[model samples]
Structure formats: C-alpha cells, structure tokens
Target: MILFCPPGVYRAQSDTELLAGRLARHAAGRDVLDLGTGTGALALAAWREGAASVTAVDLSRRCVAATRLNCLLHGAPARVHRGDLFEPVATRRFGMIVANPPYVPSETSVLPRHTPGRSWDAGPDGRAVLDRVCDGAADHLEPGGVVLIVHSQVCGPEATVERLERTGLTADVVERARIPFGPVMRSRANLLERRGLIEPGDRLEELVVVEGRRG
Candidate 1:
C-alpha cells in the first residue's frame, strides 16, 4: 500500500519495521491497531496484509491527517485518531496492536518536535511513552492477542520485557542487536550518561524489536 508521507514523518526504515510487516503477514484478517501511526506506515502495511480493519492513533494532528490521506490513497480501511497513547480508541479492542513509539532518551535532544518528527522521543529514561503503552496494552488487546512494539535497546529492552511481564503480559524480543544510528539515533549514549538516565556501568545497547502477548 502506498502512503503519501510528509516531511518530518518518522517513517520506519529499519528491520523492526520489517518485523511489523512480517507479523502482519502472519496474522492477516485480524483487527489491527497502529499506535503512533506516523504516516500510517505499519497501519498501511497491516491493511496490505489483509487485516479486516485498521485503526491508527497518533498524538500529532499532522500525523493523523497524513494517516487518513494515506489510508484513502491506498484504499485501506484505517481510521486515524489524534490523541495521546490509546485515548481515542478506548472503547474498542483489537486482535493486534503495533507501535513504533518514541523510545529515545529525553536527554537526547535529537527528536523531532510534535509538528514534524515526534516519533522518537521517550521522555526521561526513554521509557516514558513505552511504559504507558505497555501499561495500557492489556486492556485494549483481545484474548490471546499480540502487541508488537519497535524500540531501541538503548531504551532498556530487558526493562521493557520485565515491565510487560509485571503488567500480566508475556513479552519477548522478536528481533534485536545494533543498527546504524540515524540522525535521530546520535548522541543518545552521551546524553543519557550525562543526565544519569544511564549509569557508567550500564550495559546500554542499540536497537531491538519487542513483542508482547496478552494472555
């Protein structure tokens, strides 16, 4: 499916994005929710994979508008929502939840603003948004449904796994390891260390794909 993405839209150009597409392939015809649906990348991908319905949510008005336009462009059945986390879609549930939320440490000043590239900042410690996502996911997922999240190991992959487990969700690393730093990926280590978001002895890694399932 083709999406007319705008500038500053954080389009996924990594293996984790590919993992999302692959997950969609394995779960075709399921109802899907794409959180932080910037440019409707994963949302459109799920639609292309035959998801019966696709709902996209993003905090950015530009992102919502772009997602709607992209859905129309691809003739995909996607509803775009403008709100934080899962607020707009509270009354609904889905068989699959896919997100590439902002996972960069707030100490890193490389994130794009809400107007343009608000897709990579995860407040302090880089788990701000991700924590919220994990905390709220169980409520929105149907029985035996899956929540697929794409984040960086720099954002604490093991911590994310633990968080999901504590939230009553079983989690695993679908894909992991270091990838090249984009313009946004730069300076995370230094900034995080400087701000104490990461300790000197911390084993900070790069990027990974985290997948969790609601039991």
Candidate 2:
C-alpha cells in the first residue's frame, strides 16, 4: 500500500504495522474510528479489512491532510477530522477504535506543537497523550465496543490497562513485540537509561497493544 506523508506529518512505523495486523479479523462490518491517524495508514488498513465505515482523527493539520489524501488516493471511505484526541468525535461512537499514539518519553513536560517533535514527543513519562486515549476511549465507544492502542513499554502498558479498567472497560495487553531502538529511541537511549526507564546499554524496547472493551 502507498501512503503520502506530508513534510510534517508522521509516517507509519513498526508499531503502526503491529497494531494494524490485529485489525484484519476484527474490523470487518464494524464502524471504525482511528485516533491519531497519521498518513491514514491504519485507516486504510481498517477499510481493507472490510470495516463498515471509517472515521479518522488527528491533532496535526498536516496529518489530517495527509490522511485525507492517502484515503482518497486509495479510494478508502474515511472521514478525516482535525482536532485533539477525541475532540473531533465528541458526539459520535464507534464499534472499534484504533490508535498508535506518541509514547516516547521526552526531556520536557510540554509537548511540541510545531516542530517534528510533535510527531513523537509524549512528555516526561510519555503518557501525556496515551493517558487521554485510555481515559476518554470508553465514553466514545459503543456498547461492547473495542479499542486497540499500541505503545512502547517504557510508558507502562499495565497502566493503560488499569486506566481503561477504571473506566468500566475490560482491558488487557493483547500483543507484544520486541524491536530494536528506532532513531528517536536511539537518540534518547542515554536519557532513558539515566531515568531508569531502560537498563544500561539496553537498546531494545517492547511495544505492547492494549485492548479495551466497553461492556
């Protein structure tokens, strides 16, 4: 599949592919909502998986444009919206919601709004965006709906499960993959080590998929 990622939009990465793999069997006949639909990669995946309908949301205007073009190019029927997480779809609910959000721990508490850092910086603990995904997902989900979110272990996958559970959803880690450090992770290896998020000289990180179901 071909996707166009604008200059400032985030391109699909390993985690995107990982989460997308689970969509094949689950998305068919379901109305899907893709949060943080960078490049519309996951949105297209859901469409390809036979989703009944697809709606995508992104915080970056560039990403929204990128997703729109990619979906249009592929003839994937998806409604692309620009707004913060869950903001664009406040009055809507879906059968399935998927996200591959920023979970990289960064040096600063404030997130980048204009720089390339906007694509991956997730504040000090990397939950700045992750928490919102977990916290607000339940309210936006239909009865017995599923939300699948992927992120690195550095941000605490267990916490995602717990947070989702607190919202009256049954949540658990559904997928796990050990991948070597990417460019961002490699660059921040030292800081991660110093912060004890990673052991000395450890350059590998595990990405986990947390599946939450509203009951």
Candidate 3:
C-alpha cells in the first residue's frame, strides 16, 4: 500500500517488517495501539489484519500527520494522535500494543529534540524509550493482551525482557533477523564499536521481536 511518508518520519525498514509479520498473529478481532508509529505502517497492518480498532501514537507531528495521511489514503480506519510514547492514549487500553521504537544506541544521552535523529537515536545503551515502554505497557493492555516491540540485539534484548517481566508481563524473544547495517547503522559503525555495542569490523546486527503477554 502507498503511504504518505514525509521527511523525518521513519519509513518501514527491516525492524518494522519483522514486527509486522508477528503482528499478523495477534491483531485480528482486537483493539491495537501502535506506539511510536512512523508512517503508520504498523497501524495500517493491524487494520488490514482485521483489528477491531486501531490507534496510532507518535511524538513527532510529522509522524502523526504521515500516519493520518497513510490511513486516509488507504481508506483504513484509525485514530492518530501526536504525543510522546503512550501519553496520547493514556486512558485507553488495547488487546495488542505494537511498537518499532528507536533503539540504535547513540553518542548522546539526551533524545534528539530536533533533527531526523529522533527516529532512531536511543540513548547510549539504547533503552531510553524501550525501558519506558516496558514499564508502562502492563497498565494499558486488556486481559490476555500482548505487547510487541522490535529492536536491535545491540540494545540488549535481555534487558528489555527483564524489564517487561518486571511489569508483570511474561516476555520473550519471539522472532529474530540478522541484517546488514542500514544507512544509519553504517554511518554510526564507528560509534557503535567505540561504545562496545558491536565487535570491530562487524557489519551485521541482529534484530529481535520481543513479545510480552499479560495473563
């Protein structure tokens, strides 16, 4: 499906595709909340999968608009909101919450306030946003609901699993992909190696889909 992706709004990449594949397993006949939605790809995917309802949230106005445009362009139904992480949908709960949030470890500890960096620049350890997602996920999910998050193994998938488990959600790595560095990762290879995130001369990274289920 065609999408309205504007500058600075993340386009569907390897991680997005990875998450969307798993999303098909759980989206049908359920309400879905897509956090950090970019270009509304996951939101539209859930809708196409027969989601009862779809709500997409993003921190950037560009992303919100892009998602809204994509949904409108495809005649897909969705409620698009602009806010950081889950703030826009604070009072809402869903049967499935999906995310392809920023997880690339960056040199800066502070999240980018301006610049395309906001799309992929997680903090040094790459958990700035991931941690928050894990922490607050349990509260916004329905009984028997599940949350799906996709990120790089470089960010420490174990940490994410542990964090989600702490929130009372049973979590584990459900899918994985070993992919070559994309443009962004390629550009940051030196930084990643310097930060001890990757072995020297390593050009490929593993992406994992972490799924957390609430009993």
Top candidate by lDDT: 3
Task: State the lDDT of candidate 2 residue by residue for 1-215, as single tens digits.
Answer: 98897788888988998999877758998999999898999999999999999999998888989898899899987999999989988999999999998889999999999988888999999999999999999999999799999999999988999999999999999999999999999999998999999999999999999999988
Question: Which pairs of residues collide in candidate 2?
Answer: none
State the local distance difference test value for candidate 1. 0.77
* Candidate 3, position 201, lDDT: 100
Runs with alpha carbons beyond 4 Å of true place in candidate 1: 108-117, 187-189, 193-205
Comparing 1 with 3 on lDDT, the higher-scoring candidate is 3
Model 2 misplaced regions, further than 4 Å:
none
**How well is each residue in 1-215 modelled by candidate 3, as lDDT tens digits?**
67878888898988999999999999999999999998999999999999999999998989988998899989988999988888888888999999988898888899996799999999998889989999999999999999999999999999999999998999999999999999999999999999888999999999999999999
Name the better of 1 and 2 by TM-score: 2
| Cα lDDT for residue 66, candidate 2 | 89
Candidate 1 C-alpha lDDT tens digits along 1-215 = 45677776776678446556557644587899988888888888888788888899988877888889988877877888889878999998999898888887765445555444367776767777888888898899998888887787667788888888888889998776556566665556667667765566555455677788888
In lDDT terms, how accurate is model 2? 0.92
Poorest lDDT segment (10 consecutive residues) of candidate 2: 17-26
RMSDs, each prediction?
3.3, 0.7, 0.8
Q: Count the backbone clashes (under 3 Å) in each candidate.
A: 0, 0, 0
